[model samples]
Each structure stands twice: as C-alpha cells, then as structure tokens.
Target: MDFPQRKIIHVDMDAFYASVEQHDHPELRGKPVCVGGGKYGVVAAASYEARKFGIRSAMPGKLALEKCPELIVIKPRFQRYKEISQQIRQIFHEYTDLVEPLSLDEAYLDVTENKKGIESANQIAREIRETIFEETGLTASAGISVNKFLAKVASDYNKPNGQKTIHPIQILEFMEELPIEKFYGIGKVTANKMHQMHIFKGSDLKKKSLEELVRIFGKSGNYYYHVVRGIHRSEVKPHRIQKSVGVEETYWENLLDEESVFKQLKLISEDLEERLRRKEIRGKSLTLKIKYRDFSVYTRSKTQEMYYENLEDFYKTAKKLWELRPFDKPVRLLGLSLSNLNTQEKKQVSVQLKIPFPELD
Candidate 1:
C-alpha cells in the first residue's frame, strides 16, 4: 500500500525565552543573557550569546555565572511569553488548523491542504517566519519536510532565524548523512548505547535489520527502524488536550533525607500550582515519582473527590504519598504530577468491543 505524502512544517523559536527577554530589553541584545531562576536557581533558558560560554537550559545559575562573569540573569515572565505564543499560534491558524504545539516556543503544522491554497510548503514557511518577525518582533526557524520527525530535524540545521526544506526526493540522502545523536528522542544515554553497539550514524542504524533492532531496543526498535527509513506516521493534532500537569527536579547532589525531599516537593508543588493557574486547570489525582541514584524508579498516587488547585493542597497530598513510600536509598530525581484533569470539555464515550458472531452462537 502507498501512503499519501504530507507537508509538515516545524517552527522553533530560536532561544525562545532568552530571545523574548532581548526583544523586550534592547540593551540585552548582543549580550549574554539567561532568563529563568535567579542566582543559585535553575536556568530555564539561555540566549545564543550566553550559549557561547557553554550555558544551557537546566544548568544551575551559579555555575552559569562562573562560566561567564558578565552574564545577566533575569527571572522568567511566563505570562508575557504565553501572550506572544498565542499571537504566533493565531498566524499558524490562518494557514492551517493542524497545528500541534510542543511548547510555548515551538509547534508542528501540517499544511498538506492549507486554507491559503499555497502549493509550496517552503514558501509558506518563509512567509510564516517573516510574518512572525514583523508582528512579534521575534524571529523563528522553520523546517519543512514530509513528516514531523524530519521537519523537526531540518529546522535545527540552521539556527537563529533560518529555514530548511527536506524535499521528498532528498529524504533518503538526508537521513543517511544525519548523525545518530541528531534524531528526535535519541538522548545522551541512548546515543552512548548506540555508540557502544557501533551505530553512530543514520546509515549505521539503517543497516540493522528490523528483527535485530527489536531484539536490541525492544518496542522502541520498531520506531527507530521506521524513522531511519524516513517514515513517521504521526499526525499534527490541533487542540490536543493535556491529561496531566507536573514538575520534576534532578538534584546535583543526592537528596538523602525526608526533610530535603519535602523541601523539593514544596518547590515542585508551587511550580505546578503556577502552571495550573496559567492553564486554568485542576486535577483530582496526584502522583509522586522518585528516581534513585541507581536509576531505579518508583511511583505513588492518591485520588481525591475534590479538585486540587492550590500549592498547599498539592503539597499535602503529595507529601502523604511520599511519606508512604520506602526511601532507604538516596534519591536523584523527584517529581509530582496531577492527572484526572478537568478541562471542561464535553466528554463522550465510544464502544470498545463488539461480537459479530453473537447471533450465530
């Protein structure tokens, strides 16, 4: 069977949070700037200039300053970022409704049959990038391809206000030359394992048979096999409803005691509360995830009849769940998530099973 080709575009704002900071404060442009938590806090985003000093998101702010003495740190203003994100999203809707937002700064758009009747996806991407700069005073990079995976990879090829198109005819050639580390979902740990197995590039990954890959990587092997062949069947879904909202932190040092763990939980709960308020969402179930130093994982959850909306409520429930778990080992990661979401959307049910032979029986 033959599959219809799709026109997928991935738009990623270059250094989104940091860029917004620069756009708002002209003095910060062309200088190293980190936008996120303050000194002794976690770095949320780093500008391209700061990146020159090896600063990155999630890095501790104190260390970031050590790397660049003149680095300017600014707290995140998520409300302002959300406002700009909405504006960019409106522009995407003008062309196609098939937009899947990955974050406040990036989204995937399927324009195979766009409202504008434009034939070239590349032209559409260019126009979108230009319009974003003109309207929002911020620049975005775009990747155009036949699938989301390829489009996302292409978008990163040219950083900071550039675009690239991977034509259907060039897909195989492009994939062959791409590095294994560059594939979406392939992280440091997985890349290290791949290297140990002598799979260092897309061509090397493609050399492995589907059976070999499955035997090596389990169910994810099938995903790797298809993606290496330039086949990704995922759709660009619009209005994707989130089922959970959560926050996690990986401490630089192990959290050895209950007191330290509780402190981290309080911080996480506060962050989750702010995020929930931004989305106007609440959940009836709370879950706690703990990762040990050995990388082992465990989770605990509790469900309540009442919706939780505040930090105190989330912390109380999460604390109870945490206290119930055994913590003989030091913890490397801690996370709290709320599920059973209340989105206010009308819920519907569909049939799950059917027996066509019931009459004959």
Candidate 2:
C-alpha cells in the first residue's frame, strides 16, 4: 500500500499577546490597547483597536502614544503569557510528536499518521481548536493542507476564532488568487518590487519566466517562482538547536554615556529572557552590537563553557562588551544576541521517521 501523503495544520492565535492582556484585564476589553513599556519603552503588543489607529508592535511607545493618546499601555507580564503558552503547547502535543512551534502563539503540526488517525487534516484541526478553547478559555484559528506553506496561508484565511482548509484539489485556484503580501517570506519591500514588475497576484507571477525573475530578484525570485506554481516546501522545524536569539533597540535620543548603553542592555535582557524561558533554550555565548551616531557599527562577542540562565550573567557580559569597545561617538542603537545554542532542552526532542524524497524538478 502507498504511504499516505503528509498532512499539516497551522495554528495562529489572534492578537495573542494583546488578547491575553485584554482577557485578564476585563476593564480594558473592547478598548484600544497597546502593550509596551511606559513613555520610554517600546511597544510589546498592540490590540486590534490600537492597530486601526496605525499603531503596531515594536513601534516606539512615544509614537504609539501620539497615534492614539487614549491607547492603554500595559507593561509586559511575560511570566503569565509563558504560562498560557505552556497551556497551548500541551494541547498540540496531544495530537502528534511532530508539532513545530513557530512562536508562543503559533505552531505547525504534522499529523500524516496521528493519534486520531483522521483521514482529513481539516477534521484534526477542528478538534484541536475545540480542545484548546475548552481547556484554555481562549480561541485560535487553524489552516489545514498537504504542505507547510499552504497550511500557514490557510490558517490566516479566517482570523479571531475561525478555520480554513485547502484540499489538494483546490490548491491551484487558491494559488491563482493568493495575494503577494500573503506569501510567506514576502515583505513590504518585496511586495513593492513585485508590483513594479506587474505581479499583483499569483497569476501575474506566473507570467514571468523563472530566468527573468531570477535575474532581477536573485535567490528569492527562484523561490517565488515555486510559490507561484503552488509548489513550495517550507519545512516545519521544531525547537532544533536554535543557532541564535537576540534583541535590538533603537534609542529615541543618541546616547553619550556608558550608563545609557547598559540600561538598554538591561531592557533587552529582560525582554529576551522571557522568550528564552518560553522556548526553554539557553545560551553559552553572548553577542553585543553597537551602532554609532554616524551609522558606523561594531559587534563583540564572548562565550563561557557553561550556559547562562540569570540576568546578572547576561548584564555582566554586555557591560564588559561596552567597556571593551570604547566608542568615541554617541550610540544610536544597542542589541544583544545569544548564540552557539544547543542547550539542554534541545536534547529531549524526538527524531521522526524521515519521509521519502519529493519529485521536485
């Protein structure tokens, strides 16, 4: 008998961080909400209400406040969010060992042969969503399809408590109208360039010769061509020895003091530390990036034999980097990254039975 084709499901939580914020703080429900540090901090999350006012996550708190003065800013409660994340992850694990977490609020599940043994990934996705809602009192959207790329797009087809599935037979029609912006790895810059090339949709992308696309846009255009053909193989990788994790900050005003640099390093540490804990990954190496007022840049890194889990260790390393670099100009940006990963938690992952090769030309 022929082995069954792969079945993939993508789950994305709607405005995850912001929704969590609103859920806990009942008074803030239905109001324009943006989670960030106070006046001097960065945006950590933006509610749908705040998003309508042109506010977004990673935007400066000051600018977001300007956009919506009424915007309610909530300081990040990472521990709470991480707790909720664990609640969500537990739900995915029940379905298969092949769940690949993209972030706290999103994941890809490979269930070709699953605990449910359901023929339709769409049915599995629905059950998963129903279970998550029953257990967590929160909602999630899912997309089901044969491959990772198509599954991801289908999940976003409906948002905020919805589900969408694209059967193999419907793949061609789906690709024909697939918006360029909706394509994975295609950002605002690529979308504008695609428009310039008269490629508004997959049909337009189909008109271009692969060689012509390659000549203009390099390796990405080659991938775009495959996507246009409704044939892209974006794998769903699990927590597989992450090579790097880092945080960068853009300062409101140029900093001339060592204290200022350390302060931002502290802030980034606090921000990234939460992510590290959620992913259950740690680092044995630290990298510091510096950008000067004139846009000059430098990077310095140090590694210890042992993994670091506390803020004190990260701060000491970052402070040492600041002291060693000794820049003459004011600093406009500071970033902290942890690399040389492969921490203890990574060893716990299970190896899956590999599938045979695809018939790619």
RMSD of each: 8.1, 5.9
List clashing residue pairs in candidate 2. none
lDDT per residue as tens, model 2, 1-361: 1123478898988788888988888898889897763466677788888899998877877888898899888866767887998898888888787888766788889988788677878888888889888877678999988787778789888887899988877887888899888887777888898899888988888889989989988786787777667676656665454577777776656788877777888988887787677777788889989977666789999999998786778888888887886658888778988887765446653322222222122
TM-score of each: 0.78, 0.78
**Backbone N/Cα/C clashes per model:** 0, 0
Q: Which stretches of candidate 2 lie over 4 Å from their true place?
A: 1-4, 245-285, 289-299, 303-316, 325-336, 341-361
Residue 342 deviation, candidate 2, in Å? Answer: 6.5
lDDT of 1 by residue, 1-361 (tens): 1234999999999999999999999999999999853454668899999999999997877789999999998877877998999999999999998887778889889999999999999999999999999998999999999988889999999998999999988988888889998988787887899999999999999999999989987777888888888988888766545677788876656798999999999999999999888877889999999988666889999998999879999899888998797779988789999989886562421111121111210
Instruction: Write down the lDDT that model 2 would get.
Output: 0.78
State residue 165's C-alpha deviation in candidate 1, in Å. 0.4
TM-score of 1: 0.78
